[model samples]
Target: MNLDELDAALRREFTGAEAERRVVVRQAGDLADTEKAETDRGVPLTVDEIVDNLSDAPDEGVASRWNWWMGALEAAYGGYEPFQVRRIPKE
Candidate 1:
């Protein structure tokens, strides 16, 4: 999905924090761009896949869930650390 669609999807799943939501969407876009550049190396990222991956995370917030997933990817792939949601804007 495009960035707009990804933003809406994130809003649906993670409500209340606008800044954090935007951060997640931005990070997702970055991931998509990175994946697109290396299409042959990894699975293409989609809104559904992102949501599904974070759905079972042990965290309660969107940023937390996203970070959890990013951490997993970093542990397995080694480059996803930069995409991790480092700070959540106070809301």
Candidate 2:
């Protein structure tokens, strides 16, 4: 599905508090990598990697649960094509 539709689904499935928490978890992971790269500068993590990390974050609400559900839907409808809800680059 399109980004707007995915966003709407997230909102409909998640409570406001849960959404905020998810954002915090994702941002924290991204920021951690940025901090690490400041010193090493060897391999800056890609946006896709950061988003993939977030997908593994502990489920906090229906929004997170729906993420898995959407994956299943996409797999069935899109012929097993990967569906990433977060706006991250694809390799």
Specify the highest-TM-score model's number.
1
How do the residues 1-91 of candidate 1 rate in per-residue lDDT, one tens digit apiece? 5888877887887643888888988998887876742463366688888888888798578888898888887776678888888887787
For residue 10, give model 2's deviation from the true position in Å: 9.5
Tens digits of per-residue lDDT for model 2, 1-91? 1334334444554444545434433533443444543243354444433344435646655335435544553555542122233542322
Among the numbered candidates, top lDDT falls to 1
Kindly give the number of clashing pairs for every candidate. 0, 0
lDDT of each: 0.79, 0.42
- Screening candidate 2 with a backbone cut-off below 3 angstroms (N, C-alpha, C), the clashing residue pairs are none
After superposition, which runs of candidate 1 have C-alpha atoms over 4 Å from their true positions?
A: 36-41
